[model samples]
Target: MKKSLVLAMVLAGFAATSFAAEPAFLADRHVARGASCESCHGVKAPAPGAKVSSTACMNCHGSLDKVAERTKAKVPNPHYNHLIGTDCQECHKGHAQSVNLCGSCHNLDWKVP
Candidate 1:
């Protein structure tokens, strides 16, 4: 009886923790692939609320032209946006949920990240 109770409690605890925490998908994926925070941030100690720059992303993901070429099949290719500058953090947020900033003005229906 005691063993059964303990097992139920353990399962409940695991379920609670999993349901309570929202995973940072991008950050977790990077960490899984051996990417440290400093690798993406490009600093030993980043400032509070400091954002990652597009140049930093380009350093690893290549130039804007290359990214646009890769996503050329997508409708209205996000990398080719002329209205807003290509800011990686604008859509590919590391710690928070990513958003399609273009969706604010256009009805592209593209999912960011």
Candidate 2:
């Protein structure tokens, strides 16, 4: 029992340390990608016309259909709704932070009860 408890404690400590280290790894990749995120998202609020950005990124993302499949795990209507007005950074968060950044604009109207 004591041995199992100590092993669990050690694993938990490693997970905590790795979580702290994750941001640095993400930043390195963001730098290699060679663009400031703000060049796109901007201070102005997003609009439906923002679909332009999706088309631009998809040109290089290899297969838009594949990304749609993966993102649908987090967002159901990737084509018609979730990806419509938001910036790629709003949800993707590059390498550092992850989760739905769309809450910045969406928090008021969209919510789960």
Candidate 3:
């Protein structure tokens, strides 16, 4: 009984620490400037396990056409020939490391940051 109780306390402490260490979205430059959770999430706090939609990002970042055009000269267009369409969050995570979704299938050496 003591062992079980001790284990539960340790697990609870670890869970609390993990939650406290989570990075805040407000740490991002866009959010620091003026953007709020509502800007992307449309709520003060999203429901547990809720996800922000691509449209929420597009509202500020503009359409896929605009993104493709802007990046056409500098880099290979991830937006244009994407197999998964323009779900920006697939590569453009605001609060975490951005990934190049194209890297999953193609060997394109494009650096997505």
Please tell me which predicted candidate would have the highest lDDT against the true structure.
1
TM-score of 3: 0.66
lDDT (Cα, tens digit) per residue for candidate 3, span 1-113: 69999999999999898766654442275665778878888789877676788888789879888878888775456777735466777777777777777877778776665
Runs off by more than 4 Å, candidate 2: 16-60, 78-85, 102-113
Evaluated at residue 91, the lDDT of candidate 2 is 51
The regions of model 3 sitting more than 4 angstroms off are 1-27, 82-84
By TM-score, highest first, what's the ranking?
1, 3, 2
Residue 64 error, candidate 1, Å? 0.8
lDDT, model 1, position 21: 65
TM-score comparison, 2 vs 3, better candidate: 3
What would the TM-scores of all predictions be?
Answer: 0.72, 0.41, 0.66
The per-model lDDT (C-alpha) reads 0.80, 0.51, 0.73
lDDT of 3: 0.73
Q: Model 1 misses residue 70 by how many Å? A: 1.1
After best superposition, candidate 3 residue 40: deviation in angstroms?
0.5
TM-score of 2: 0.41
Check candidate 3 and list the clashing pairs.
Answer: none
